[model samples]
Target: MRRHTDERAHVLVLHGGQQHSTEPTSWRQLSVLRSRLFAAAVARAGRQDRIGVSFLRYAQRGWNDGAPLRDATWALARVREEHPGIPVGLLGYSMGGRTALHLAGEVDALVTAAAWVEQADLPAVHPPTSGRALLLHGTEDQMTSPEGTLRAAERLREQGAEVDVRTDLADTHGMMRHRADWHRLAGAHLVQTLRTSTCDAGGRGAD
Candidate 1:
């Protein structure tokens, strides 16, 4: 893992998973591979800036009633341990997005990509007290509920979150249809939210 010990800001990237499964995760999985690629793109896009990124791959494949959340908690703690009080961001997809929801309150900014949000999940979200959030989803996403994502965004907004929700027309849960757009939205969110344009890099990556 690379280290940007002087990083001014940080981003933790998380991949998606199923709602109910205990299967171990691997780099070969589509969701994990996609997020790894996405994290690299974010790092490259923010190359001129000072940002540290860590991509967290959960030990198991499913949400499994908060198993991924536990992993994310540890990852965030790791980031805090590494960077201390520097601004932090959370970027997650699907089930990982669900995990991010539980931890968003701890970061400076958050981006949920094609997240699998349910009405019941909103209560667990304690909006970033001094931060904000962005929710991205596809209109045609069959695997996750775009409406639910929007609803979650609304709830976040009502709770005083500076929320912005965008939709990809005719896209799906895979995020491959409009890959660059996802990159643009998610990457821009990190750079803008973290304000790392002038910050340093070679930040540690979560392996």
Candidate 2:
């Protein structure tokens, strides 16, 4: 990871399930897409200098009976340790989106794409108290139910968190269609949310 000279909000991109592997690459193609989109969004907003991106590679790729949550937690801790006082965001896809939603309270902003939240025990999770969330789902997603994502979003909203749920009518679980729209919405949400947090913190900065 390249170290930045100045403090910047850090966004950690998490990938979905893959064939189990002991020697996985630190970053995957999906994660790369997410990171690039987020970076581009920030750049377009003229806030690229205030944000940094990273990836979390799992030791094994099956979601591991929720073990990925531990990995995600550790990654967030490391970000806090290395970039103390800066804001941090979590962006996950599919299984990774479930993990991001689970740990939403720990980060400054949360974004999930085609998240598998129905079976993730999301009803028991509390909404973030001081952060914003963006949940995206495909209406035609056969692998994961878009209804599940919408339900979760409603729950989060009822709990007093700022939540935005978007549905793509012409996409599937992979969200191959409307990829640009996903990136733009998510990236803009992250930047805007972090900016709000910064203002709330007296302009110190936010994740």
Candidate 3:
């Protein structure tokens, strides 16, 4: 078996997007810029250079027919191929969160911020069978419903994964109202998950 030589942990970052469209995404998109902030903040919160951050630039701007999922799969394959058995995590916002949640079974850890979840989004809630998940949702999100995120969390628990759901009161869909807390919680979760589930990230181990 190939061993994990690098001590650094890898995180694949995914940004938010639209719905039912076919436009290609770009770095100039505000959605990508927001996710870029997430990546940078998470990296800084982590063990400095020990955390490898790669923000995925998707081919399209929407989740049309699971295009984002495909792009994420491709990106993950690259990460695994180059880094082999290193601890890998997924961090996403909104539509990107939806995409990461869809592929939770394949990574060591995952963080979903302001995840876009509707009734239709439940079918893709594949929690990490051998890892952990952190769901961060704002209590006052105007775009994605926090109730929907709660429902998704319920499914994640039912599937028998170690899941942590945190609510940021007064924050909105953009997750900027308490930006420092959001970054601290999410970045801490990802790095701590990479370390160990029983660590000080305030998460429990798998049952």
Q: Give the Cα lDDT of each candidate.
A: 0.81, 0.72, 0.81
Write model 1 residue lDDT over 92-132, tens digit each, in one string.
Answer: 88887888888888888798888888888888887764456
lDDT of 1: 0.81
Model 2, span 1-207: residue lDDT tens? 224567457778777774244445455456445444544554454255466677777776676568778998999899998888777777788878888888887778888888877644676655653646888998888877788788878878878887888985579876767877887887788777766665666554343
Candidate 3 residue 6 Cα shift, in angstroms, is: 3.6
Q: Could you give candidate 3's per-residue lDDT for residues 1-207 as a string of tens digits? A: 112235467788999999876888888888798889899887776655376788898988988878999999999999988876567889989999889888887887889999887788787787764457889998888888888778888888888877889875689888887888889988998887876632323244222
- Model 1 TM-score on a 0 to 1 scale: 0.90
Per-residue lDDT for 175 in model 1?
A: 84
What is the Cα-based TM-score of model 2?
0.83
Worst ten in a row by lDDT for model 2: 18-27
Clashes of 1: 3
Candidate 3 residues lying further than 4 Å off, grouped into runs, are: 1-7, 197-207
Distance (Å) between predicted and true CA of 197, model 2? 1.1
Worst 10 residues of 1 by lDDT: 197-206
